[model samples]
Target chain A: MSDSCCDGNARKAQAGDCCAPDGNVMLLSCSGGSNVGQLANQACVELTQEGFGKIFCLAGIGGKLSGFVRSAKDVPRMVVLDGCEVGCAKAIFKEAGTLLRGYVVLTDLGISKNKDFARKREDIDQVKAAAKQASQAQV
Target chain B: MQIKILGPGCPKCHKTEEVVREAVAEAGVQAEVTKVTNTMEIAAAGVFGTPAVIIDGDVKVVGKVPSKEQVKSWLGK
Candidate 1:
């Protein structure tokens, strides 16, 4: 149960209702050691703030926590964002034996991977769009 | 042979159990069928999807309710 008033029942509840976290979609980001990774993390943060979905911990799943792994498996919809083709996020899910759904690779979105910590707003927006699109297509 | 249905007791999970039982009876296979409703157990079994069917330690289906015919085929009917 959420404390927010918007429960998808009110006519005022728009698509990106920020009243509460959307349980329907879960966001997982790589947050690795790269600019693209930072972008992925930033995009997820912004999306969660915008109520697109609730950001979940990939580390918990990577650590093989029973509760975290179970939650990841049980979530109705999930968006996984990876910084690069190395697919750190995807590997974590695979190692946990969890099914991957609504996956997006930042590099695949025409964003180049680099050591630069400074991420561009345009790249972040692109990642966010790609994440939303992937989630919609999958669930 | 051992058969396990993994889920959190959702409607689909129950439906899967019913179909699996029907297939077992129709196929006349000497298999023990059980439901695993524990989330931890399901994860330990390496199944991330609900309404999953595991036969003889092999995962046969995941995330969807399979038909009776599909279960029978797994039972070699």
Candidate 2:
């Protein structure tokens, strides 16, 4: 009997050992009006699909929604991906009085911010890697 | 002093309440300790975390259970 919950899944059976979705990890990304922002958003979407974590509504926290704020605060693990140094996502957590953990800034990954809406695949991959690294470090 | 433990009745929240009560007794402080399990009340207090400890309306801890010593310090012991 495998002790890991993910081991029971056929997907994990094919893919080998992997982490199961515990529903404790939350992902928040900045969907700002910029390429970097979109990169962050795109990375979060992909990561969620891969079961890295579930993408949460940053706007809810920003709007001071009670349920969203409570969920964000109570989650055992959180990944915050910001498109740039502008730190809109980070600022939201700060303003909401919630502890910001596992933060990653796309600009810090050497991906320069631009007005281009067409996000590059390489940049998206880089952001995803950074986001994964940030989340793993917290774990 | 008013002390409130805010959580949605998780095990950690229960542990927090126990730690707080013990802290109050050991600190010998004249305080009223209350457990707040209501989600709206927890959020309305401007706290987003569970197992939160509020002392006299000021949020002291959130999201994690605190040790007895930590609770005692918050009680000014």
What's the lDDT for candidate 2?
0.76
Residue B18 displacement (Å), model 1: 0.8
For candidate 1 chain A, the 10 contiguous residues with the lowest summed lDDT are: A1-10
What DockQ does each candidate score versus the true complex, computed on alpha carbons? 0.05, 0.07
Candidate 2 lDDT at A15 equals 51
- Model 1 residue B23 CA deviation (Å) reads 0.5
- Each prediction's TM-score versus the true structure: 0.59, 0.61
Q: Model 1 over residues B16-75: C-alpha lDDT tens digits?
A: 899999999989999999998666676566544456788887677655678999899989
Error of 1 at A99 (Å): 12
User: Per-residue error at A7 for model 2, in Å?
Assistant: 27
Over 4 Å off, model 2: A1-23, A26-31, A41-78, A86-101, A108-112, A116-126, B44-49
Report the alpha-carbon TM-score of model 1 versus the true structure.
0.59
